[model samples]
Target: GRKRTFLACVTWFSVLMVLCAAAPGPEFFAVVRFLAGIGLGGVMPLAAAFTTEFAPRDRAAVAYVIMQSGYPVGGVAASLLAKWIIPEFSWHWMYLIAALPLITVLPAAWRWLPESAEEQSVAASREERRDAARAGLRAIFAPGIRTTTVMFWVMSFCSLLFVYGANTWLPTLMQDDGRGFSSSLNFLLCFNLGAIVGGIAAGWAADRWGSKIVVTASFLVGALAVLAFSGADGTALLLVLAAVAGYGAVATQTLINGWVTRSYPAQARTTGVGWSLGIGRIGGIVGPSVTGWIVSATSGGTAAFLLFAAVGVVGALVAGVVRHAAR
Candidate 1:
């Protein structure tokens, strides 16, 4: 169910991305972008849900982490492309290039992606299907789940606050600290690169140790990384600290994803992860704006980094309290 729906959503997403590229004016572009974002929104959570269903129990965390790492891997790829496309072509051309996935990847996914056994079970009974649809909403917070449900939402929120905050502003913060524009953007490159590497490592660790501790440590270490960056001086030192911060900041999401996917039953997994993702997007939207306002008000990089560090602290504490059920 998630896979077929995913295909449908990505098909629409590609169409919208093309529409965005060809839009004649700001109003049209904005509308297209909104619709495109709606399509884009479904891809990840559903992918996570689908991945959870197929992943081997013993290697669950690793499977999810490998999938999750693609987020930053994609960001890194786009950043590299931007190096060439933004100058040689226009922004619309970038959108057109993004639309390439529809042609190249969609066909391959259609051919290769398996429908989960869970999807078949739902289809087997019309009466059961209705019950499942109803239960999906109720099950995430059903008995024995309410506390963890709320905890997961909070963890997702706090994790994304710093994740998106760093994504949107780290370069700007670097620029404010006197690095050149290119150099500042390079920090973003470094950050995402570390995210790719760190996500895999975190996933492997989570599989071995459990997500609660792993995620908590990620938040604490990332916070410290940001603090260390505030004191960093040389270009090499700054990038190194940025990489460390990226490692922790981005890996936090990886751990949560694995936990949510692992913890929720298939009947309710989509709803669980979907709601968690929706909550995190709220924080993601607020994060950049909040950081921007704080930076403007304080007029200092130290204040901004301190604010993000504090978010990490909050995330760490929240993560520490979320216990893994024996399931």
Candidate 2:
């Protein structure tokens, strides 16, 4: 229900953008963008929950990897489509073209996806629903869970800070470091390619060993990669480090989500995952702001890289505590 509501709102807002953009005014475009952002904010967590719920027990990690890869794959497709269309059609047509996939997918989603079984079960029992809701709130503060919750929160903060900050500003950083446009785009492609590989590999490792070890190693290695990337002066080295960081950075969240799903029972899994991501969104906001400030205050690329690398280290340490708590 909530997810559907979010999608409806986004669809409406997307239409508004088209109409507003047609008018050609900054304020209108700004308002439309804000609306679009609200829609985006609601979709991601819901999608994560949906993925976990639908995924089979044995292949949960693989499911997450495949589901998360959609973002990069869609991005690549959109870029190609835009390149082909933008020369012949107006920019508005590009937006319209993007809407085609949503039209096809939304109908399939409406027909196929099941309501969350946990939610449905809760609804069937009024007393149980109340008790469960109370317990859900208390679980985050319970003796066994309090530390785990805090650890995950800290991990989320650092992980998102690095992920969003690096992705948002890295291209500009590359250009500042004297790389050409083609080289920077190549770096992005390499980075996303690594992400696809990393997601699958991390999932397999987590399922085989444990989410803890996979997450911890990912953060530590990711931190090192980011630090090395800070001094990358050559195109080859920069692309290599970007790919490594992408592998580590992108897979960290998937592993963390898997951990969350396994740590809590099905009844509260959605709440746990939702709350963690909600908290992490704050980090997502802070990352870009902090990076922008660092760029203004110092050398843009290097300072931002160092800040993100430091964040990765903090995430690695916190993830250890989370692993302990889970055990």
Candidate 3:
């Protein structure tokens, strides 16, 4: 059933994200993105859970960041396609061509994916597993950690809200400030370019400075960048601000994920990270929806940007206040 679940979700995930290949127009593309977001909502967090679960304990943070770094890498690829592929062929081709890799990944997953060794061992040792499972549940709620977990959850919620909101609306936000469609597209490219750099920088900084410090600063900087973008109507200025926003929002999120991975031992790491993501997805769901509403209601994207910028502030404060609860 685990394999079946993985197969089903992965298949849908791959199919959905790439289906933009066939999109007819703006409305259809938006619908495709919606459906793809649904599949992605399932696959991405689970993939992170698996990576952290199997990684060596000492290097779980590195493993988590490295695994998740694919997110921004993919963003960079999409931005490149928007530049080169879309012009050469179409956005449809861009999506379809990128899906080519799944030809290998799907079959490899089917043939080789297995429960991690620890999970397999837990399956074999029933009594020990029962005991460990109970303690794992308790560990999350035992005083200090309970506070940290709650703070982490709140921070995750706010961070994702900011990430998804800007990611979905940044183009429109730029255009609303009088930039042409071309400049808006260029902003997306610069934003994702910033994301790729942010991913690398976050990993390096987290390792040297600690996930908490990196995450806190990421949120803080992201907040300022986003707030500043409201006034950055100049094309070059806006592009630079977009990159800062990407660094702050996207990089901060990966570091928070790394934090979740590091906070718990192997026994509960999957549950910890998975649940944190699951619950935080409340914000993920709300983000784009609310942004759409605000943009429509106000007839501009300025309000949406400011609202989400304030969300970045909340995330920064939460990350700053939480005491580390690693066990």
Candidate 4:
């Protein structure tokens, strides 16, 4: 079921991406992109649930972080690709390139990606399967599960706020510090690269110790790194802080995803993950807009980063409050 859902999402988004490239006007493009977003949104939770279902139980975090590492890897690659593509051709070409996954990844996925283990275990009538799904959705809010669900929402919100806020503002913040365009862009690369490497390391740490301690510490590290951005001695130091902040923001979210996936009953896992992400996206939606207002109302990048750092602190606290699940 997850495989089928995943493939359909991929196909839906891919076709819309091509339409985006050919849009006759901004209004048309915006509507098509919104439709495409529906497809893109479904893919992530299913992918997480699918991967979690198949992972060795003890190594769920490791499997998840490995899968999630693809996001930053793709981010790093896209930054490089966009630098060339936008300058050489136009922004439209970038959309065309995104659509290439239809031809490339979709076929491979259709042939190979397996249904989630939970889905396979329940070979039943359609009504029975639907009933199971509905029960799973309701289970997330039942008794002991309800508190953790709310805490996960808080953690998810703060984590995404850190992620989108920094991503939307990092380069512009760097430029505000009197750096050139080329130098500013380098921060984005370092940011994503940090997430890729740091995320894997954090995953290993999560497996060894636990997700709770590592996630809280990562948020604190991000907060400290972001606060230090204003006082860094030079570009080199700033770059290092950017990397740490990336680890704090992006890598923390990846860990949260892993934790969310592993925390739920197999039947309710996708519903749990989906709801967490759905709620968290509101923070993502707010981050860029709020940071934009902060930057505009304030004098420099310092204020914006400071606000982001404060949000990271809140994230750390929220993460700390999460009760660990019993084995």
Candidate 5:
């Protein structure tokens, strides 16, 4: 019910943004962006909760990987569309172009997505005359869950740090190193392409092995890839490193989400997933800001990459802790 209300509000705000774009000013644009961000923020956790509810018992990891992979895929498409249309049309047209997908998908989602069975079951259990009270949010803080929760928070922080920081600055970093704008953009393309491949592969691998090992290995590889990306001088090397970094950096998100799902019971699953992502948004905000600040201070991307590499190392250690705790 709350999700539905939030979605309605976001839709209204989006409509208002479109209607007001014609008479736009700085204030208007700011309002629009703020509204859009609210809308985007609500969608992710809702989708994650929905995915967890509907996914098969054994295929939750694959479901999350596929869903999360859509983020980068949408980004890639948006980039391509903006490049093609912004020159001929205007920036407003870009918004219009993006809205088309929403129009199509909204109806489909409404029709197809199932209500969360966990939510229904919880409500029913609460009303049952002889039912024993099940574990609640407090269970998430129990010793068994506390460690995994902390580890996931750390992994989420580092994964998003690399995902956002690298994607935001990688092109500019390449261009600063004497590469052309086209080359820089191509690197971004290759990076997201690698993300798609890596996400699927990581899901399959995690299902076979365990999410802990996959996450740790990904961070270790990502740390090296980011370092290599910082020093990549040739197009070939840059592309190769971008692919590696994308695989390690972006795909780790899938593992983290899967691990979190397994750690909590259905009753607390939404809260757990929401809290992890909410805390990780802090890292998301910090990653780009800190990277930008370091680049400004040092006048080089090398220092920024080194900082991110350190973050990845921390993530690797956190993954190890999570594995130990799970045992």
Candidate 6:
């Protein structure tokens, strides 16, 4: 069933991406992009749940983190692709490039991806499926788990806020810090490169130690990076800070996702991960907008970085407070 849902979401996202490429006007493009967001949103938690289900119990967190690394990897790829494609072809071609997953990943996934045992059981009985769904929802809120769920939600919100806000504003912030135009862009690249490396590192560390301490430390590391960014003087130092910030923000999100996968059982995994992400998506929506306002109001100074760094602290505290999984 999750395989079916994953395939449907891929199809939905791919089709909408195609529509976005062919959009006639700004309004049409906006509407189609919003619809595509729905597809993109569904793909994430489902993928996380799927990864956790198939991975060995002890290795699930690492596997999920490795999978999550693809997000930043994709970001790096897009940045490179855009650099090449936009000059030669156009922006529309970029969307067309995104739509290629329809022909590539979709068909490959359909051919190779297997449904989990849990999914197969539900598929055989509709009443059992309904009961499982209800049970999963119930389990997330049951007693000891409810507090963990809420704290996870808060951590997700703060992590996403750090992620989106930094990714959207890092370039501008770098420029404000006196870097040249090209160097500003380079910082963004370093940032994502950091995320790619940091995510994998955090993953292995999480598998070795556990998600709780690793996630907490990673968030604090990111906050320090963000705070140090305000006073960064040399280009080399600024770039290093950017990379660290990326590690702190992006990799922490990866760890959080992994923790969710390791925390919930197969029956409730998707529901738990999906709702946490659903709430985090709201923070994602707010992040860029709030940063834009801060930039406009404060001119992307120390105050902006301070505020974001504070959010990172909040995320660390929230992660620290998440109790052991109830079930």
For 151-192, candidate 5 gives per-residue lDDT tens digits of 788889888888889888988888888887666777788788
Q: Give one digit per residue, the lDDT tens place, for model 6 in 12-38.
A: 999999899999999999999999999
Candidate 1 C-alpha error for residue 136, in Å: 1.6
Error of 4 at 23 (Å): 2.6
Best candidate (score: lDDT): 4
State the weakest 10-residue window (summed lDDT) of model 4: 115-124
TM-score of each: 0.95, 0.85, 0.82, 0.96, 0.87, 0.95
Residue runs of model 5 more than 4 Å from their true location after superposition? 1-28, 124-136, 323-327
Model 2, span 1-327: residue lDDT tens: 435654675576556556554647778767776666665656555666677777887777778777877665654465455555756785666656645535765666677767776666655576876777677667666777877877887777788787778777776777777776555556667676777788788888876777777888999888889899877667778788888888777768767766775566556665677678778878988998899899989966777878877888888888776644332
What lDDT does each candidate get?
0.84, 0.72, 0.75, 0.86, 0.74, 0.85
Give the number of colliding residue pairs in candidate 5: 0
User: Model 5 Cα RMSD, Å?
Assistant: 3.5
lDDT of 3 by residue, 1-327 (tens): 234555666677568657677776789888877776666566665666677667776666667777787876777667666767766776677667656546856798878877667656555576776776676677766776888888888988998888778878887777777776667778877777776787677777777677877888888888888888876656788789888898887778888887886787666665567667777888887999999999899998778878877898889888888887444
RMSD of 1: 1.6
TM-score-better candidate, 1 vs 3? 1
lDDT per residue, candidate 1, 1-327, as tens digits? 667788988898899999999999999999998898788778878888888888888788888989988888877777677767877888888899878879987998899988778967865676776788678889887888888888888888887888899999987887778777667778888898988888898888888888888889999988999998878789998888888888888878877877887787778878888888889888888889998998999897787788878888988898887765625
**Of the candidates numbered 4 and 6, which has the greater lDDT value?**
4
At residue 48, candidate 3 shows an lDDT of: 66
Residue 14 in model 5: lDDT: 56
- List residue ranges in candidate 1 displaced over 4 A: 125-127
Q: Is candidate 1 or candidate 4 better by lDDT?
A: 4
Instruction: State in Å the error of residue 172, model 5.
Output: 1.5
Model 2 lDDT vs. the true structure? 0.72
* Winner of 4 and 5 under TM-score: 4
